[model samples]
Target chain A: MANTTESNLPGDDVLEEPVPAMQQLLDNPFLLLFIGIAVPTVLYTIWGVMEIVNLPIAK
Target chain B: MAVNRNFRTCPTTGLVFHEPAEKLMRWNAVVAVVALLVGGVLAIGVLLTRWQAVHLLQADLFYQFLTAHGLNMLVFWIIFFEMAILYFASSTLLRCRLATPALAWAGFWLMVVGALLNNYAVLRGDSSVMFTSYAPMGAHPTFYAGLILFAVGALIACFVFFGTLVVAKAERTYHGSVPLVTFGAITAAIIAVFTIATGAIILIPTLLWSLGLIEHIDSLMYRTIWWGFGHSSQQINVAAHVSVWYAGAAVVFGAKPMSEKVSRTAFLLYIFFLQLASAHHLLADPGLTSNWKIFNTSYAMYLAVLASMVHGLTVPGSIEVAQRLKGYNNGLFEWLRRAPWGNAPFVAVFISIVGFGFLGGISGVMMGTEQLNLIIHNTLYVPGHFHATVVIGTTLAFMGLTYFLIPVLFRRKVAFGNMATWQAYIFGISMSGFSVFMMGAGTLGAPRRHWDISFAGNPFGYEFPATAWLMIALMGIFGVGALVGGAMYLAITVYSVFLGEKIQTPDFATVSAKRGMAPAPQPVAVGATGHGAGVGAWGMVAPGTFVLALVFLTSFVLYYFVNWKYLSTVWPLK
Candidate 1:
């Protein structure tokens, strides 16, 4: 109902349900939270141990 | 909610400010500024000592000040402010009561105590190990203890934020999805949890080592794990500041991101790839294979970089769309030209976006590149690049929000409007120059922490090019000027908060009425829009923004290859 000239888009006024998948992901903060925490724990932190554990002990 | 649940509606913005949450935010922000003051003082010593012209502090004291500066500015000041931002994003934006105000207060005090204790150790003439605190060069036990405590406190704050979100959801404080700004804060908090946990994992061992409980902390492992904390701290800033950008656009122009899904997808990329980009710190270190380095730096890092690039385009592009929608359609840049240039919040946010992109974004990509990072690693360029990102990008955006918060949150008319506008430009532009000049010196071979650029006392001293000295001198001047701008900002904020005229019986519409203008001219904020259904001369929603982005890309391409050319020239090929 804004007459401020910016709410002119076709879909700006009323958002359609069944939001797009990426948006659905954004909408679910918990899922994003799970993925955000999990991905790094796997690839960066746990995998990081693999990087150094295999190195030959310094003489 | 155990804490006070009183809510006061902001007359300016109409968002209800939870009383306890507002108090928490004000205190954290106040403490953050105090930390900035301490760090800024140390920066003067740092700037003078490293300038080669001044050489103010001796080597030991220089390192001490630098250590304190790094911790206070990068860790304490930033994270403390971020805690406040999280509260604002959740309890404030969602119009909900804070979940656990008691826990938040406990976290705040713990953070404060830890900060004071760390400064105590550093200034007591022992923990001059610098920000990295790499193994073998041990600091005082208190230093490690303080950092551990602070990390724990920040972790608690992050959880409180999450809990508040749950409270909002359970209570149905907001309809449909959380707003984009709140979502951005969620990203930041998620990243903060990761950063702080990573810090705890490493710093706890470091604390044990400092206390002589452990025989040795492997320097390699320590460096690797520390960067997971150190570098990802910047990732938190990236998320937070990008949110500030979106929030600013919404408040100022009623602008939404051109595509909310695209922006959120970009954040998803950050979650997946950003921390891995921390491997750039380990690139030059021995024992890491070329394969890991190449994959992490070139491939994974670029994806993270892509996320930032997506934000860079959308933030301004959305603003352009909003302006065009308001009928600023005379030319490609009339919208930009006729933007709310006089408003402090608008100027600060706009300048932050452009400076972060052109200065911070482009340079960051070049420095993150596997091959090119070697050229600038361990040089002044590291600090210079971060100055752009953290100071220009993050701090400026925070300042912009502060300007906005003054009128709305504090319920005071911001004092010295004209001076505030100039303060934005002064701080942004001067800091940009200071960073670039430091990078110029770094490119000419200035070492990172060395007190003297000339290496006057060393017997086997190698002389840098003449241009290096010039670069250092220029940076010093610009750095000092930037400090003055920072001082101005502090003065303005302090005065406005305490002494500015109060708004009683607040009618937000009265300002436009007083100005005798049509209501349409005033930027009455609607929520961020996702759909763009119009056309411009360039057959796009935001042609002017596209032009600006093309300029950014062109600069990035040119600078990137130029670094490559510089590297090729210096390569010791057989």
Candidate 2:
């Protein structure tokens, strides 16, 4: 078993830095929510891959 | 950067260093690359075969490629990537170093070796029984070899996780109890041990049989035990998804979930009930007793679902509290309205959970029912159900988390903005469309894995789900969009790490607690400094060497043992 140690590094108690304009735009919380929604949607669509790949293409 | 003094020095080592988060992010990126390479190969292979367009490869090669895709992309890549994420949750988030770095390396190497052996064995025309590897359809001896190696590696990784957590606890890195996200990861690691143990039990004996050391392993026994591993491993994915949610919420809301104690306890619940719930997968199978299936699928499975439900209720509940605290009180709906819409991680978390709930959860329940299972058993519907839960729910969450990792962990900048954002949406939307289309088509009765769906007259008669084939093709249009999105993501990430602008922010920041809401300020650079001696050399050590060593060990030891079996032993076959 490994041991845990408290960090004495700087910024332990400092307030979190402000999000820059670029980051503000980059942080899309809904995207996370969307991923949750997408899981079942994609899984249900597993057959799509089969259809396209399984088709009797002339080539 | 050298001129800019862009890199910070570690207090412990007095050497200029990359951020711990950056190191972890690099690890994740590499892992993602591996996953995509293997997964893409497998996906393409399946496409060709399903379309009956295997230009040159024979049946054996086709099956071999299929086996590789399933094992490599699905099991190997996902698990390894998950381990990297788990490590981040445990150490980086907590502001601590890994407890036993050596053990982590061991775990990583083991996994790599296992992956190599499995892939090589498959390519050699040895393994083709499908990822479940149903018994009696045994592959070349190397197939078992690869499987065993991989299982062992996974086991090692689990232990490394335990070691990391232990070190953190001992160091007083956390205040009272572990954070909810880390707690979830720990629970997942514990389950992984049991899952891998089951996998090894079945695969080892099969290996022996393949090498002619034993007459044969009971096919039924192998099936029973393998599923114990197979199904349970998926629960581990579930555990990881939940962890991502907590972490994602923290990033976006500056809000911790309500009742940290309850959330942590919920994670522990997963460890207890998760692995035992594998019976849910066997409900439709013929050999299991009806009572056994009923108890396992209905009752046992409920406990696991209940664990998830607790989190489901709690996480959103906490998010609600957080938003209120952030002062988004136009009304209850106002909090949701005010929530950050642009935070990538937050969106990923929300979307991932929703996917799991409506699509994954609904399908899971449907599949768990004894009677309902008869309908979806081998159809395109089954795959649809899993992709909903696993790919969209779990994999997508991990991807969102990667955005944070790039700047926070690796200290590297992201390549492009609109491109990354668009890629994420494209992938998510296409995949969602694909899954929904398949499930709907499945209800109409499209069989999964069929090479040709153009039957003369409906296979199921008027009850046939033939229209599903058309839906499936139409869905492919979305898949193309998804594939392009995936490519863009890779390109942007590569560009960010290697060529993106280099700017550093102080570690730790807060954003509004609402969903999809943009941060009020710029993203902060949250990083850590070691308390004791640190290894912060700007060493140019080759990471690929470790991967090579694993491959070498697997090939050398595996072939020697196999040759010994073939030469010295006689087959028990008639």
Candidate 3:
């Protein structure tokens, strides 16, 4: 691999620069994981369960 | 290299592989192909019986083997290979050691055992309840147990993948971002975690019911929960295979994604909305509210479809741009024409992108539509749609990646030099034909999962249209060809793994350095503070790809309404 340390030398402010807001959210695997799990759970599983439970008794 | 710290650097691609992770990947892939071998054998019986002239298997054997075929191909084979992809994407792509290699091996063994037990349960004759072991029709407890074990193992593996990513970051493996391919793999792993959890949610209780510990389980509940596992399993495949498409482009043409932001957002859309496509199976089912149905099938599903469309365009678009940069920019399709037609990995992935987009994507959108689904919900068309998506989309892409992996990871030259390329085209073409004919037979009312569509020996005979019969026969013929193609893939893969000559360093270049280099993104704007923003296209880089996407959109629009037109021909609603 090319010398990454050369680019990451002490004076380079690139390491300290702020990650863009969208990049921050997208790059965090845990946050994305939470969103991925929670959204699907709410939209599909929980909502489907609610609909199923509310069904009137078939006479 | 020692066992604990062993890492091998590929001279060609310059990617480093952790030894344990590589071993795990190799074993997982080998197991996946073994599962494919089992599934392919069952496919022959299934196809022959459907052919009607041969009608090889009896009804009992047919259902049993069909169950095995579905489980092996859909669940076992696909998941095992995905586990391999996860390891590679995380540990190899990110240039880090695999975290907790022992835990990964445990997961692998559990998966292997679970697959064996599941197949055993299905083939035992008593547990022939088919892939959707719907409630009120109980199988042996072991069938549910095996699947649960498999899902648990898969969940464990997903965590291992996530852990590897964490290790990579802490270790500072790559500079700016993990490559786009790794991001896509993470998307797949996230979906996988959700899928396995859904499987456990439904299957555990069903296992109890099968053991007679519970009195009853609701059929409706069973179905709703199962499709969450069932169809969302395909969602994982979508994410994984799409990653392969991106990686294939990079490997074959040194292509970079046009915009990392656009591609990543498309993956983000999948995370939020893709599982709602589980509702595609439920659109025809009773008791589900129309409002609920419409929301899932319409708005939510469209977002997911949009995500797939974006990927479908960008993978090829990126390829076209790379080719154009290589100076093939005469006309719109000159870039495509000048592509490496005889290369196995290139041919396979290109066919996958086109076939999946044209055949699978359009059909999927139509099926997911609430009204259009009514026409072909539980028919041969259902399998036809998935064969395009799952077989052509996922399986073929995986095969392409395998050709690349054989030389790089396995360090073996591909065994069937020219023959492997033929295998890819043959598989792509035959399977495309099979899917179309199957859907045609389905339009004329051929039921899926029926051992005999002819309705032989029934007192009240129900004969389908003659064209349906021809359609089915043609489907069978094409299906047979696909199976032969599948066999060729197996032979080529197995021979290469065990017997093909070893490759010395630099013998095969996965990503050629000097040739096919993607040009740097051009400046989109100049900031006030001397900072400049760059983007993929300085001007128009991929006009050919734009035309192709327009073609796709046109076909999709036509197909969407054609289904609506077909639905209108049904008995008019009052």
lDDT of 1 at B338: 84
For candidate 1, lDDT tens digit of each residue in B119-173?
A: 9999998999899999989999999889888888888888899998888776556
List model 2 lDDT by residue over B181-249, tens digit each. Answer: 766777677667767776777788888888888896655456556777788788888998888887776
lDDT score at residue B77, model 1, on the 0-100 scale:
84
Question: Which residue window of length 10 is worst by lDDT in model 2 chain B?
Answer: B528-537
- Candidate of highest DockQ: 3
Put down candidate 3 lDDT per residue, B429-486, tens digits, no spaces.
9999999999888887888877888878889778899999899889989998899899
User: In candidate 2, which residue ranges exceed 4 Å CA deviation?
Assistant: A1-59, B1-25, B48-62, B454-463, B504-574
What CA RMSD would you report for each candidate? 5.6, 17.5, 5.4
Model 3: DockQ against the native? 0.42
Q: How do the residues A1-59 of candidate 3 rate in per-residue lDDT, one tens digit apiece?
A: 12223223234465478889999988999999999989888888888878998899889
**Count of clashing residue pairs in every prediction:** 0, 85, 0
**Highest lDDT against the true fold, candidate:** 3
lDDT-better candidate, 1 vs 3: 3
Q: Clashing residue pairs, candidate 3?
A: none
